[model samples]
Target chain A: MLSIEHLTLQLPYYTSWWRRRWAEVLSDVSLELHPGEVHAVVGASGAGKSLLAHALLGLLPEPKHQTGRLTFQNRALTAARQRQLRGRELALIPQSLDALDPLVRSQRQVSWAASRAGHARSDAWQAAGQALTHYQLDERGRQAFPHELSGGMARRVLTAMAHVSHAQLIIADEPSVGLDPQQRNRVLDALAALALEGKSVLLITHDLRHALPIAQQVTLMNQGRCIETACASAFRGDGDTLATGYARALWQALPDNHFGVLTTTQAQNVA
Target chain B: MLSAYRLHHAFADQTAVLDNVSLSLEAGEWVGLNGLSGAGKSTLGQLLAGHLTPQAGVIKVDGAAPPRSGLQPVQWLPQSPELSVNPRWRVKRILEEAWTPSTALREAFGIEPGWLNRYPSALSGGELQRVCVLRALAPGVRYLIADEISSMLDPLTQLALWQALRQVADERRLGVLVISHDAALLERLCPRRLTLSEGRLSPPARHGAQSA
Candidate 1:
């Protein structure tokens, strides 16, 4: 339902009152997410994964230049269109739990999202409770403030907020970071469940292992370029099916499959 | 050696965060501290780093209290580098404020010379973190407490930083305490590991026998 084509982002650095220089941060990146599929964009930090999310959401920093064709549901996505769809047809599960308002109660936060999605106040409140229940949060959890909840609980609450909005496309940026193993699985499973419900998901993460199980298509990124896009099933056994040497090296370097031989593709690239 | 005995700490609400906790690290040793979130591992690290004073218990390095001023022998690298840096100051000032890093040291950390004139805001999180790590590894430091210092970094940056740290520790015989939740990371870097649960410390399951 979502498609990005040859997206490039550049930030301008002012050298003087009249002089300026631009640095390219993202270049010629393209990907697509179909309805009811989880498309994972896997990359190391600074590979511009978050930048792609921001560019799609029209939240790039000022003095930035972007050129790309972004289409959602066969319609070109302009800045105004992105603003229109945000929080309704398009939602983001941000990387930081700090996205939740510290002063607001959890229930009110989810309800606000429901209200934003065009529900009446009374209906929003009911939908908020249902979302909480669906996410396995108890009544006490609904009443608890952000600071009072644990990290895992806060993550579920964020998911509940997105669920209440009923967005068609959900972009989760490293949602599992800082979470324990069980909690990580829970969050990933929730995203997978959302896909099963006919919502398209863009799962942006650094760990390949976390994305492989639920992701149908994995886009490997390096240095702001989409290095390779492969089926999740292609990541088995020595990674010969993987298109790029870097992708194969990445798979082999996993602790479970590490052969103790380092790939010389790039020292800094191989974490 | 760095050691803590019978450490007891509580928050403003009188909730005990750490109770009777004790641990010790010898020079040139790499030790891992593993725990669930909010398990008081950070509290213990802060106590040892002299950031917090425990209500009871004692922390000593080489049978003496930590120096009160002028280049601490024990340094702490917190989880977020953003909090530790001065936004208004240039990167050069931040690095030289604690100790002057040699050119080789700066080169080893991959800190660009151009970054010296830029503010912390101009650098990425990993770059700022490298500066923080270099600052903590200043000339006189004998013991380093890294509390989730690399949790935010990518695997490449994390490995690069850890390799630099390992080299420095080997050369200086520094005692390093690494706090993290990644068991595989601990297994690769630390020869000894300790698990903290609800204010108690025990030897990790996979790693045998705590050193007395």
Candidate 2:
């Protein structure tokens, strides 16, 4: 379980030339993620989803200001403990597939993760193989280097790492990004499967169409603020037209879709 | 122009990740590659772009083999735009690495002069992505391979980049192979689609058909 209270982060040098002017990335935002549940964070671009991920994982770059109480379960995660928790109690599946080590074999990176967490190399190999297989990766894939694999393969390798580490909490940013339709399904299914197995997932994405269906709870962030949080099933159903409206707005915002534009022009004409 | 003939590649005992896959692109053509996870879409792209060699097949770009491994005859805009840039390099230096002022690269992406000096870390994800794309388009390549280039971008930026890519490809008579999971975007951009499965390549199912 995870909980955040009155979190605020600012970066004075983010806009460099501005000097004394500080740019606020995340405002007084707060939320909770529970075991056996998938909490989705949704927002438009620049809504601070990735910024929040970096802050929560204590990976925010230097000269950044962070003031908040981040408690995992019940204990406060101070600077030192947060660093230790990054790869041990918490795991991250980065937005990019190439986040894997290009020079290292897929197995080696997993082994490194396991070894750093005090597990033996052989155990890590076995766990990595098993995790890869769980994500539908077969024998050949388990031995391939990062560059040798495709986008989807690299994603699967990362998912396998998350699973093998068995981190208590997994923070996945844009888990379905760059995947094809079928691969999107696989990635979503894998995350859902993890939730079903009692792991907590904080899925950060801008696409609600995919996350809304799979996540048990949803939190919408706008301009670094936690605007809304509600039950996923109910939110998709009758009670909350807001989430549905937002989803429709995003679908309309899709650049290549002429249908939305046509409909809007028609409405203007009729009016 | 780009073409692949009976391309086949694999790491080991398993079936080739790209099994005898063949495809071709002519000037001004925009193709989309779609498939399930681990189905070899990127592999096929890399092979066509000369990033990887086929174990038993042939690839030709403008009637010749690509110049180098991991190098595409066309420019490539990878998924993670932020990491693609060198942290210490200023945006001007980063953009300069791929383009020369003698070329019309800046005009293609509408990149104004002032943005060149800022480091990538200072920019937003969308901003960085745009820069990466502009850098890719800076060179006068006749073709492009974009691997989920818009995944990290927001809907607005996504749409803008989509239009820019289409426009540039048209203006330069360039061929483009865009890889993404967004079915709707693929439907809107590409007249032809390539579907991969079990490490094999073939034509996509009809529009609205079930996903692989």
Candidate 3:
């Protein structure tokens, strides 16, 4: 349902008043997502994983940023189309807990999301509560303000907001952070259920173990570049089936695995 | 040893998050705290680090009240490094806010020199976490409450971080309380693990078929 091809984004800054310099933070990122499937984009901290998400959502702040193609459902995702489709056909579960409004309670924020997603005004609140409950937020959690809620609670509320939306594509950015084992599994299962419901899920995360189970396709990134894209099955057994050395090394680094360290070159580049 | 006796805490209009919880750790040992989210693991960590005072219990470091002023002996590294840092400050200033970490320590944490001039907002989540963890290791700091600090990092980075921390922690003989949801990670990092649930602390019963 969503496709990005050779998408690159560069932000310009002026070293001096006369000279403008561009930093290519995102480079040559390409991926495909289909209905009823979950695609995971995994990478290190500065590997520009989140940048790719922003690029797809047309949230890139650069005016001169365009060197690739983004198509959704057979139509080009132009700037205007991105604005028109955001929050209705496309919803982003932001990485930060700061995305939730501090003044509003969790349920109210989710209700607003449901209302914007074409739910009737009268049904919005009920839909929000159901979504929150589905995501494992109890009644007290739903009533707590963003600051009052724990980090994990706030993140679930964001996922709940996306869940209540009528969006066909959900971009969940690090939805598993700060959650316990059970809560993390619940969120991942919920995302898988979304895909089972025929909605496309683009899960952006750093944990391969958690994402590999539900993700049909895994895109590995390093230093703003796509390292490899492979089926999730390629991650098993010493990662020998994986296409690249970096992917194998990442898989080995899991605590349950060999706990492999990054090679000198890859380590130096990300820092 | 650092110890807490019968700690009790609850938020306004909320049930007790921590009920009669007590834990202790030696100066040269590593312990892991595993719990579901909202099970009061953070509250317990905060109380131990003196960030919060318990309603009914006392925390003592080396048989004395933990000093509320001066350099804290027990430091708590929060889960969200971005929120714990100053957005306007450069990475260098934030890393050096409490004390200056040496070149070797900086390298150990995989902090590049180029990032020092960039603002905290410019660094990715894992990079900022490295800075925060290193900053909390300033001199005179004895215990560390590392609360889900590596959950946002990739596996390789996570392994590297633990290896580096182990080296430093061993050298300094610093006690650490690792709080995380990843049971495998906790098992790898700590020899002793505790699980917090229902406002109480107990040993995790999962074994034989340990899984994430």
DockQ of each: 0.37, 0.36, 0.70
lDDT of each: 0.85, 0.75, 0.88
TM-score of chain A of 1: 0.94
Cα-based lDDT at residue B180, candidate 3? 91
Q: Model 3: which residue pairs collide?
A: none
User: Who wins the lDDT comparison?
Assistant: 3
Root-mean-square deviation (CA) per prediction = 2.7, 5.8, 3.6
DockQ class, candidate 2:
acceptable
Give candidate 1's TM-score: 0.91
Candidate maximizing DockQ: 3
At residue A51, give the lDDT of candidate 3. Answer: 85
The best candidate by TM-score is 3
What is the C-alpha lDDT profile of model 1 across A141-199, one tens digit per residue? 99999998877789999998889889999999887776666777888999999999999
TM-score of each: 0.91, 0.75, 0.93
**Residue B95, candidate 1: alpha-carbon lDDT:** 90
Give the chain B TM-score for each candidate. 0.95, 0.85, 0.94
Ranking of candidates on DockQ, top first: 3, 1, 2
Fnat per model, in the order shown: 0.12, 0.52, 0.92
Model 1, docking class: acceptable
